[model samples]
Structures are given as C-alpha cells and as structure tokens.
Target: MKNLSLQWRITLMTALLIGATCIFMNVLIGYSGRHYMDSIGSHITGYEETGGEDPDFFDPRRERLDQELTIVIHGAQESFIATNWYITAAAALLGGVLAYFLSGHALKPLRTFAAQVEKVQPNNLTDTKIPEAVLPEFRQFSRSFNQMLDRLDSGFAAQRQFTGNAAHELRTPLSLMQAQLELFSAEHPEVSPETADFLRLLREQTERMTQMTKTLLEMSELRTVPCTERIEIGPMVEEIFTDLAPLAERKNITLKATGDGTMTGSDTLLYRLLYNLTENAIRYNRPDGTVHIAVAYEASCLHITVTDTGCGIPQPYRESIFQPFFRVDKSRSRENGGVGLGLSLAWEIVALHGGEIRVAESSEKGTTIAVSFPTDASAD
Candidate 1:
C-alpha cells in the first residue's frame, strides 16, 4: 500500500469503501429478512402442540406447516446471501476501474506541468509560462512557477553582465602592470636580489589574475557560438600540439595522436576544450613521460581520449576536478601556474556541444580522460 502509485491508491480506497457499504447493506438486509421470517413463522404455526380433545394426540398439520416455514426461510436466506455476495464483488471491481481512470484524468495536468518544467533550459527560458486558459486548479501554481522562472532568467542575465564588465575592466590594468614590470626588469638588470624576487612574484601573480579574467570573460560571452562548420579532430590536434609544443618540450613529455574524428560545433570552443585537456596532461606529467591522444567514432559518437603519465587524480576528486577553482593538489597546481579554470572551461565547452567529459580511468601508472560528442540518431 505504501509503495502504490497515487492513482492505484485512490482506486483501491474507493473500491474498499464501496465493497464495505455493500457488505454492510447485505448484512442489514439479511438480518431484517431473518427477523421477519421469525415473526411470521411464530404467528403462522406452532412447532409442537398437543390436541385439546385427546390427551396424547399430536397436531401433524401445524407441525408440517412449521417445518415448511423453516425450510422456506432457510432457503431464502441462503439464496439472498449468495446473490448479494456476487453483486458486492462486481460492484467493487467496477468501482476500482472507474476510480483508476478518473484518477488518471485528474492527474493529467500535473504530468503536463512536469514535462514543461523539464524543457525549460537557460537558452530557452523566454515564454515558459503555462497558458492562462489552463484549468482553474493549476492556474495559480503555473503563475507562481512562471514567476520563479522569470527571476532565474533575470539573475542569469545580471550575472553575465557583471562578469563581462568586471573582466573587461580588470584586463587593461593587468596588461599595463605586466608591461611596466617587464620594461622595468629589462631597464635595470642590476636590481637587488630581494627586489628581483619580489618583482618576479608580483609578475606571476599578475599573470595568473589576467588569465583568470580572460577565461571568465570568455565564459560569460560563450552563449551564442557560431557552430556551423564541421571541425576535424586531426587538424585541431595538430594545431594544439603546435601551440603547446614548447610546454611539452619543457617537461620532456612525448605527445602523440592516433586515429581521426570529426564533430560539428564551435571550433574555437572545441579547440579550447582539447587544448586544456592536452595542456593539463603535459603540465602534470613526469619528465620523459608520454601523453597520448586517440580519437575514434563509435556508436554515432566521437570519442577523444587523452592519457598522460602524470600523478593520477584521487577517486574522491574525480568529479570535483571539473568544478571552478577545485584542485586535487593545490600546491602542485600553483607550481604549474594553474588558476584551476582550465578544466572548468573545458567542461562548459563540451556541455555546450552536447558532449560528455569524464575521467575514464586513473592509477599510479597514468590517467586517462575521455570526451564524447553525441551525433544525430539518424546517423546511427
């Protein structure tokens, strides 16, 4: 009963009520019939009575009448009970069927409301209100739901505007500071050791801030990417390798790509996703270790695997690695000058293209990250 759906619950309760009523009426009618039979029988004839003229004579006619009355009353009671039981059973069954259908009809609006809520995504938030012409019972609920959606839309819009403005405002000052510091370092190569150290630390921190702001600005404005062109994974891999060749060389890690795949999405965003994955693979990897990239098409999906001989992520941090500013080893990440937004941006990019990214496997030997882009079902 606890696990039953609302519809079934209602139906069962209604049927039980109807069955109880029928049984109660049946018992009442049966008792009334028995009482009436007893009253009529007692008046109609006596069960045993001796004759008045003769001392030992019996009245067989009255005895026979009494016997007939008993038989008729018992037969009528038995017939009435059996017939009423059948009628009670039928009424319960019919009541359950009617209740089930009626309950389904009553709950149809809730199902519709749930489906509409499911379809409300960030990009498609406008005009998400349920129509005013809906049933009176749902009108208030729908109005409240639409108002909540309006608040969410406004919040999102305000957040994007603030992030974009802040990033833009901060970028110029950071760039100016970086240029001034570099120029100063070049002009005075004879600075004191303490001053040099302070300047270097300041430069690193400034660079970190600049990178974070740039990434944030990109994220804030990533809503309307022109994803018209089909991007080939092979060429994109080549480009990322060329850009990060110096970083790989510095770490003495070998980079390799195997197989070819293609997907249709924003080329710029997709490039960043791969770049971030590959860059992280190289950044955290051991000296002379290997970073391998593999792309393939399987089951109407494009899968890209990046495996690196780096310190593997712990089991608990696997999911949190995609979150902004989350790091498994904060100290090591800082040594690599990571702001922790590389993987976060990668995640957002993959999600924008309706893809998935996850840590496929990790161990002492190496870690493998898998990215998949789903294609149209018709292509399958």
Candidate 2:
C-alpha cells in the first residue's frame, strides 16, 4: 500500500524483483527442457526408420533397444523437471533473502545519521562529526548532513550575537529613563497634581518598556538554553492560569485551565509556552469570550492546546504567525500593545524544548493551537 513505511516498502520491492527474475529464469529453463526432450525423441524416431530396431541404428546396439530408449527418455524427463523446479525455487528464495539484507545494510548509515541528528543540541551543534563509511551512498549522506549542520551552527551563532546586542541596546534607554524619573520625582516633592499625573504616566511607560525588554531578553535566552531539566507541565499550566487570570478578568475574557498537562522540559520555557498561548488567547478574544486551556497526553506525547473564541487566524497567515514581527492585523496587534514577538518566542521555546507547535485548526468560529511535547519514554 502507498501508506506503508520505508523499510517495509524496500523489503517488498526487493522480494517482488527477486520473484520476477526467478519467473523469467524458470521460463527460460522450461523452454530448454522442452527442446532437449524434442531432440531425444527425434533421435529415437530416426533410429527406428533406419534400422529394424532402434538398437541397430543407435550407437552401441542392445537387445531390448526400444525398452532402453523408453527408459532413458523417461529418466531424462524426470531429471530435467526436478532440476528445473529445484533451481528456480532455490534461486528465488536466495535472491529474496539477499535483497532484504542488502537493502537493510545500505540503509543502516541513514538510520544512524537520523539518530545523530536527533541528539543535536545548540551548545554542541559545532560537533558535527558523522562516522565515516566506505559505501558511496553513506558517504554522500554524511557530507550533506555535515553541511546542513554547519549552516545551522552559523545561523544560531549569528542569532545569539544579534540577541545579545539588541537586548543591551533596548535596555540602556529604559535604564536611563528610570533613573531620570527617580530623580525628577525626588526633586519635585511639592509638584502639582497635573505634574504628578504626567510623572505617573512617564513612570508607567518606563515600566512597560522595562517589562517588554525583559521579555525580549528572556526569549533570547530561551533560544540558547538547553532545557536539560524535566518539569511538571500540569502545575506549570495551572500557575500560568493563576497568574494571568486577573489580566483576563480585566478584559472580561474568561480563562479556564483543563486536563493534565504532563511533559518534560525547562520550567522557564514551559512558563513562556503557557504565557504566549494565554496572551494570544486574551488579546484576540472578543468581549466576554472564553479562552480554554486543555492539557492532556495523547499517543505518548503531551498535548497542550489553547483554544480561543476569537477571530481566527487567516489560513494564509497561519504559517507566518510564528515569524518574528508578524501580525495578522497591524493595527489590532498595535492596539494589543505587543511588538509581535509573542508567537515567535512561543515557537522558538517549543522548538528548543524538542516539541512541535502547530495550528491544529482554525475557522471563523475560533482557533486552536496544539503543542506536542515528547514524553519521557519518547524522549529516550
């Protein structure tokens, strides 16, 4: 069937090829056997025509020539038939077995390559040594895989440098503003109500700036961090809900945490994971709409689904939603007060945690994002 896996497909194809070759050989041998039988029958007929008996005409005359000729013909027929069947069957079975093993041996390097790729971490990505192989097929695969790793290592290094530079640059201005605000407030102890309100607005803006800067730095760190620690994901989801409930309440968005979300990863990354989903839910939700957080295990993987009763993400932009600085509606995203890095950070965090985040479904009704984190059994 078309849906069969690669190993089975390879084995089946090999077996079929062997079977076809065996059938072809058998046909050839059958034809030869028929020719041999015909030649012997003609020789006997010629002897009968030339002499009174086949013995007189045949080489090395015998008393019972007809009987001897008939016995020889029967023995030849049986031997040819038996040999033909035995050789064909033996060749077919041997070819099939040989094919199966050869196919497996040829693919062994690929299997090892895949396993090596799975264990690659950002910190150790520079170590891209794939074991050598004498076979050309494996050698080519190794070269390509190493090339890809080289590119990834360079890309991640560049990203780290950029993140470090950006975070410092953004933080410097906020730090200056905060210090200036403290000095101004201290000096203007007798300031008027209007001036005080203005000062408060400035302080609020500075605080928001500081929070946004910290979130950006955290996102950057998440990229470089190897989440070696295991975390209880259910409690993490519950904690995130508890922390963000007030914000949802302020917007009249009801947030509900349901199911048990148990997975393995860093607590910080898990926090970010829940935060991004909840924030998206709250930002996109309609007035008095509900945001449901469902966390459960499925197929030996932890499934954390965030469903929101909001205007769904457009089909065209669903993939782009995870791109940095990408927003469905610029004005709406601006009104929501995010720089459009929420989903991007979420995606990176999930990826770093060795999980997959995807839009399971979306429609005019709402959107559902399903995140799958491998269980301990799976991770091993």
Candidate 3:
C-alpha cells in the first residue's frame, strides 16, 4: 500500500466502500422480497383459513397459486442480483474516478512545498522559503520548515565568518614566530644539544600550526567558491604528484596515475582535494609501498581513487577519520606532525562541488579512497 501512489490508494478505498454498500442494499431488498412472497403465498393457499378445505386435498387454484409464488420469488431474486451487479459496477467506476482527481487536488500543496524546498541550497539558503499553505496542517508544516532553514542559514554564516577571521588573524603572528625562531637558531649556533632539540621541536610545532590555520581558512572559503571552470582531472592529478614526488621518494614509495576525466568545479578546490588524499597515502605508507591514483568516467560520474599499500585504517575508525582533528593512530599522527585536518578538508571540497567521497575499501594489506563528481562535458 505504501508503494502505491496516493491517487490509486484513494481510488481503491472508494471503490471498496461503494461496492460493500451496494452488496448490503441488495441483501436487504432480497430478504424483504422473500418475506413478502411468503406472506402472499400463505394467503393464496388459505393456510390461515380454519376448516376451509380437507387436509391433503389437491385444489387446482391453490396448487397454481403455490407454483406462481415460487416462480415470482425466484425471478425477483435473480432480477435483483443482476440489477444490483450493474449498479455496483457503475458506482465503483464512478467512485474511483472521483477519488483519483480528489486525492491529487488534496496533495497539491505538499507538492508545491517540495518544489520550493528543492530550490534551497547553501548559497541560496536565505533566498527561498515555503509559501503559506491554504490548508491548516500544511500551513503549520511550512512554517516549521521555514524556521529550520532560517536557523541553519544563520548558524552556518556565523561559523564560516569566525573560521575565516580567526585563521587570517593567526597567520601573521605564526609567521613572525617562525621567522624569529629561525633567526635565533642561526644566531646561537653554539647552543647546547638540549637547547637545539627544544628549538627544533618548537619550529616543527609552529609549522604545523601554520599549516592547520591555512587549511581551516581554505575549508571555510570553499562554501562560497563558484563552480565555473572545467577541470581536467588527469592533468590536475599529474601536477599534484609532481610536486609531492620528492616527499614520496624519501620513503621509497611509488606514485602512479591512471585514467582521466573532466568535471565542472573550482580548480583550486579540486587540486587541494587530490593533494590531500595523495599526500596522506604517501605519508602513512610503508617503506617501498605503492600509491596508485586512478580516474575514470563511470555511471555518468568522474571517479578518482587513491589506493596505497599502507597500514589500513581500522574498521572502527574509518567513519570518524574524515572528521576534523580525528586521528586513527594518534601517536603516529603526532610523530608525523599531522593535525588531522587533511581528510576533513578534502571531504568539504568534494561536497562543495556536489560530489561524494568515501573509503571504498580498507584492509591490513591496503586502503582505497574514492571520490566521484558528476561528469559534465559542456564545461570542458
């Protein structure tokens, strides 16, 4: 019943109700007619007349009356059944037609509200609102929906503004601190081993903070990035690998790229997306491990997958790994100076482009991360 459309459901219910009513009326009429015939037969045969005829006497008049009554009763019953069937069928047909149109009309407001809701997106969050419905129930629903959208639009705006401002303000101080440290280290070349180690640690932590701030700013700004460029994913992947090849070389990891496709989105965001995934693959991989990147057009979408022979992500941690500051291996992540924002940022970038990303496969042997974007050749 849930799988059926509203119009058909209404039609079926109406037909059943009319059909039952017709059956009840026919039964009542048939019962009344039988009772009336029985009374008439009793009178015609003189059963109520005491001592009017001998018992078992065959009177032609009375016999003819009995036969006529039986015939009349059977004929009336047959006629009533045939007539009721035609009336019932006509009533069912009429009820179904009326119910179909009535149901569609009754649901018009809901359909209108759905259409309005579909036009609301992050960029147009404040521009769209469901109109007041004529029906009281639908009007209440519209009001609630509009209120929710208002809260979301306002909250998102505040968060984005705060992130962008904080990141921008922190960068100058962070950069200055880094410069001062470099100068201090250079000036005090004869410092003790303990002092040198402390300075190195300080510098490393400073660099990590700077990178984190930069990533936050990028993620905040991504929501407003317009999708107007046709990015050839093949060349973008190639360029990212070229820049990170030296890093991969340190661990003897192999970087490979295969397949190509095109999508319409911000080139900068797309680069950041691929860069983050590829970098993580190389960073966490085993010595002599291989990182393979593949791109292809599948099911009307452009798919990009990064597979690495790294210690696979544990099943329990896979879902949370894409959350900001969430690390599967906290000790290893800290040792590698990772703040755990890479995957989170990458996920946001994909979402901004109306795409999807997921951990396609993971095991002790390797892990695969796949991203897909709707294919659009016109943008190319």
Candidate with top lDDT is 1
Worst 10 residues of 1 by lDDT: 46-55
Q: Which residue segments of model 3 deviate by more than 4 Å?
A: 1-26, 33-65, 68-72, 78-136, 375-380
Q: TM-score of each candidate?
A: 0.76, 0.71, 0.80
lDDT of 3 by residue, 192-300 (tens): 9999999999999999999999988987888678778877888998899899989999999999999887777888888988999999999999999999999887787
> Arrange candidates by lDDT, highest first: which order?
1, 3, 2
Pairs of residues clashing in candidate 1: none
List, residue by residue over 265-364, the lDDT tens digit for candidate 1. 8889989999999999999999999999999888788889999998799999999999989999999999999999999899878766767899999988
Q: What is the lDDT of residue 311 in candidate 3?
A: 85
Candidate RMSDs in order: 4.8, 6.0, 4.8
- Per-model lDDT: 0.87, 0.79, 0.85
Q: Any residue pairs clashing in model 2, and if so which?
A: none
- RMSD in Å for model 2: 6.0
The residue pairs that clash in candidate 3, if any, are none
What lDDT is obtained when candidate 3 is compared to the true structure?
0.85
lDDT of 2: 0.79
